[model samples]
Target chain A: MSTDALTLDRLARMQTAVVLGYDPKFPAARRERFEDLGLLPDTTVQRLHTAPLGDPIAFSIRETVLCLRREDARRIFVKSVLP
Target chain B: MSAASLIAEEEKLATVALVGSPNCGKTTLFNAMTGMNQKVGNYPGVTVEEKDGLLVRGGRKARILDLPGLYGFSAMSPDEAIAREIIEGKSAFERRPDAVLFILDGSALHRSLGLLATVLQEGLPTAVALTMVDEITARGGRLDTLKLSRALGVPVFGVVGHKGTGVAEVLDAAVDAQSWPRPVVAAPLESAVARAAWSDTVLQECYREPKKENRLSRRIDEFVLHPVMGPVIFLLVMGFLFQAIFTWAGPLMDLMSGACSGFGAWIESWAPAGLPRDLVVHGVVEGVGGVLVFLPQIMILFFLINLLEAVGYMARAAFLADRLMGFVGLQGRSFVALLSCHACAVPGIMATRSIPSESDRLKTMLVAPFMVCSARLPVYTLLIAAFVPERAFWGPLGIQGLILFGLYLFGAVTAFTASWVLSKTLVKGSLLPFYMELPPYRWPTFRNVFLSMWHRAKIFVSRAGRVILPASMLLWVLLAFPRAQADPGVPAAVAQSRQLQQSFAGRIGRFVEPVFAPAGFDWRINIGVIASLAAREVVISTLAQIYGVESEDETGLVDMLKKARDPETGRPLMDFPTAMALIAFFVFALQCISTLAIMRRETETWKWPAFAFGYMGVMAWIAAVAAYQILSRLSV
Candidate 1:
């Protein structure tokens, strides 16, 4: 298969992906779901909050900077292409 | 693929392997699918735990293999190697799985994609189970399952394993999936940079999300993960936990103690006076009850720890302690294993499988038993209540409670010190960086908590039956045999003491008294100590039997012990210094046969367990002697 045909697979194969942020109202079960999924939120990524408004969260996963809304970031599947 | 071809594939693929990264809700999903139909064993030639369960759906049955969580196909540790071998059809135990259920975390797609890619590359008939979908949508994010499925050229089903949401649909799709095309050999990404570039491209195309931050989690982490306040909070939490273990379990422990005594009295009343009656009433009932009384404490400890784990504060505690652990040349991950030792060292040692480094795992295993496990609770409770006064230190903290807390603290300190020494001498290694994900905090489900507590209680009770029962019977034989002639003038307690001294255990205790003399132990204490080697709590039962007290009457035994005098000096046998020395000894002693046997099993060798026994034995003797000498001098 061409690399394009394997684009999704290749992304899945990346060693690291940044977690941008998560929703404040994120259910404990859902957070536990992530833990169950082996993505330990605290240990896996560094969370950085912006001053005054920590609305958009930033996390570095292997040099990838992901900026996502708190609500939408709970289940982020990012694979950064940066070397 | 045509339906006929799909049918052929499904026929050959009778087994489904649930593969995912560690903590990916894979086990939970497996439980949902298999329910109670699972068999757990060790893989051939390795101690890695293997779980196999039956997956029954639509009148069709397939075997499901729950492999240990793996990061990739490249196996680094024994656990990962087992996972890799089974996935590659190289396992001696079973053939390659027919289909792969690739579990992916819906919330953290980027991290999981790498493993998913590897699974797809293997060319198995694979289906994606998008777990944590509820968490995703709950966070105001939606996953385009169909779009993502079409994009990846495979079936993707969203599932919430615990809630049974969309799980049946996922299982149906997985069972019906046709053979997937194997990836043609392509030039592998030669550098880390190339791999990252590839992952970036694939994620950008398939996954869609709203730009947002998790503000609530951040606000909580600010305090929870704070440096100074974090440790303070952790200490306060632990202090409360230990206090609760004592105070909360008091009523239950008392009830168990009372019930055992009543049962023993009832048995004694009906049974004829002979070896059989003595064995049934004193040996079996007393031994089992002595251990059973501590069951409430064990259950409560596990229940509280599990609640904390469910709440996700354990990870943060580990994070804060990482630096201190590093200073001791151990990983922060060892914190959980050590914490778990409070309930039982066996599980705590088993939990070391998560420590990737070999040296670190071994060190953690060695020190785990040093933590004051529930097995020691009975001994501590007995000793502290007898020796320490009931007066309050500051407000509600009783002196006895403070001493109990001190013993726990002493265990933890000694364990850390031992770890440092071992890291420096025996198992030298650099500290590995801590990489752990702190799950979002939530309320613990009552079902989950209750089940966990129930499982621990079952294990403790079963062990009492399996290991303690036989050992108790053996001890009874040793103490009851070589029957002494009954003299009318001899008091019953004195005759029983004479009978015990002439028995095999008594002989052994006498033979060892010279060695134990420095620690203030006489022949009777020596016999209790020897019997305790079978299990620590047996010391209490053995002492009761030696003193001729009814097996159920603990207070009577305490009164006897208080009046016990050394024939040579006429001083009380259990003086304040002697009690302190005995407490010190139990604190450091490796007296649990079960713990040693488990260590042997986990390490796959007798050498380490033997070493643990030898070192701890020596340490216990020295600590006991020093405690006795120092305290005696102060009393004089």
Candidate 2:
């Protein structure tokens, strides 16, 4: 499975994952914060929105935005949120 | 009428807090808004203090909160934790600030905006206080404040905080918005996940492409931050500042000394003979003047340093020296406190709070006493004048100032080595990563510069009165008492001192003499050093008293220091070997009483302070012995 193929949907259910990498192709203003947000390896994040510019993929963890780039989204591992 | 009444009833008092990194002109804005109508009080539950001021805008008073300078609201430091707990409204401290005024340094908005974005997401009635807007434009960069203001969906005010420009309008907008309920956080997320929408929207709206590079800043940084050139610049700058201490103070010091001694002599004649005359002329005037002579040098050194700090170059200097400091097992931030030691060490120890780590602060506090403070200026100046020839040793270098600078350098190096050894043995921790934002340079305002210098000079003089005065008087009493019968055929004056030399203090000096002999310190120097435990300036006065000279004798300090005779060998006491040894000893000795007081305050346990003093005492002895032996062998 291509890392880019792992969508936020794929990420939300992951029991454990690290932000192994990131892609700047997305037009995120705070790429560094997104990278250095100190997210634990293999945490769950539920995707909420995809902005009009096809970047700034917003998600929720403890009700905080765990925004990530498309490539960053791929690096994270997850189990499906679906039962 | 119904809309107005409903809106009025719904409004609640709220807070707009300003938080940013230090030196970002936040205080200036706070001052302009609050003036003297501010209060500094600790947070209700935490020891960390908070400053709150009331600002009137749109005919309503809004509480302006100035939190501690936090680099980010997240992270584990107490400062950060406090900010986090407050924002979350989970802490025992007052509820979450009603709103936050995210002040960003316009010149460095990229990083500043990162913090701004975090604050904006709190779902509070927020605004952006864009500071240093003029500096950005002046430096060939332009900002569309309106663009930023619109994008963030909140009021954004372009303010030059220091000059009070555009701040009034900013306050008016803020105060007006305070009563209005927070606008629906319109920037969209999935309706189900609206909670995270605010964070994403704020980050997107408030920031733009940073100017590719700060060209002039980069050029200067290259040389100033170069490892090789950096330390050289630091040394040269410190050398210049220390040199100015003596060279600049010469005329003023002379004027002060002359006025004091002349007044002393004049008073002696006018006063009727009795206890009154002795107490007034000898105890009060002479002792006070002795301490006052060093004030000029202390003020001058402090003035230069305060200016450097205000102009923001000191932080850069610290950044440059971080590597070298790490080599010696200290963080670069400790350099600010150590640099302050040149003026006095008490406040320097207090300044170590910026170090953030307990062990690092402790290490800084332990070594700070070794930094030759202004109290030692009199002793160094008197000795150098006595021993070193006035002729320039290195063409342009003033021999006296060079020696003074050397003494300061010896303390600094020894402090570094001491901290390094402690780290290896007791303070076992790997060096933490040091991160500091370099504040953009600014021309320091004259009022601020002078006020800071005045503050430091006031501290030095007050310490003299509270500590030095009684300490000198006690020694004076010890030497003056126990009048022995005059030896037959000897003048009563000469015989009195001879008899007094066997007094308790004198005997104690003799008893301690053998311990100091390896360092070539004579009995008088031994007494001077012991008396100096109260404060170093007393060493000069104590020596004067021992030499049977009045404290106001301007010439005796120089002459006696030169003429001091070694008891065993009957040679000049402060010759090359002894001079070097004395300098080295003062360099390593933690002799200042205030240092002891501060150490006790900083470390609740007296045991650690006792250990600190014991460690420095042993180090001082070893250093003095080594210096004396090395110089003596060279002479032979």
Best model per lDDT? 1
Candidate 1 local lDDT, residue B78: 68
Q: Which ten residues in a row have the lowest lDDT in candidate 2 chain B?
A: B188-197
Quote the positional error of residue A59 for candidate 2 in Å: 30
Instruction: Please compute DockQ, using alpha carbons, for every candidate against the native two-chain complex.
Output: 0.04, 0.03
DockQ score of candidate 2? 0.03
lDDT of 1 by residue, B107-217 (tens): 566667766766676778788889877766666676788877765667788887667788888666655544543343144643323334454566676555635534465
Number of clashing residue pairs in every model?
Answer: 35, 5
Model 1 chain B: which ten-residue window has the lowest total lDDT?
A: B1-10
True lDDT of residue B531, candidate 2: 70
After the best TM-score superposition of candidate 1, give how far the Cα of residue B578 lies from its true spot, in angstroms.
Answer: 4.4
lDDT of each: 0.68, 0.64
Report how far off residue B193 is in candidate 1 (Å): 4.4
Winning model by TM-score? 1
**Candidate 2 residues B1-636, lDDT tens each?**
122122333655456677675566777777677665565534543335566667776578666777776555533455556766776677675557777777777765544554555555567777778888777766566667777777676677889866778988877765664653343444433321232334335445544434443455546645764547756887787677656764677788788979988898999988897567867776778678766766786577667767877776676665555655767778666886787677677667755655655677788888888888877877777777876778887878987888788887878887888899988888765222233445556777655566545645554566334555665566656655555554678655456446457666677788999899999987877877877876787777776666655446658667877776645578775787787788778777888666665555455456766888899889889989998999889943
TM-score of chain A of each: 0.33, 0.50
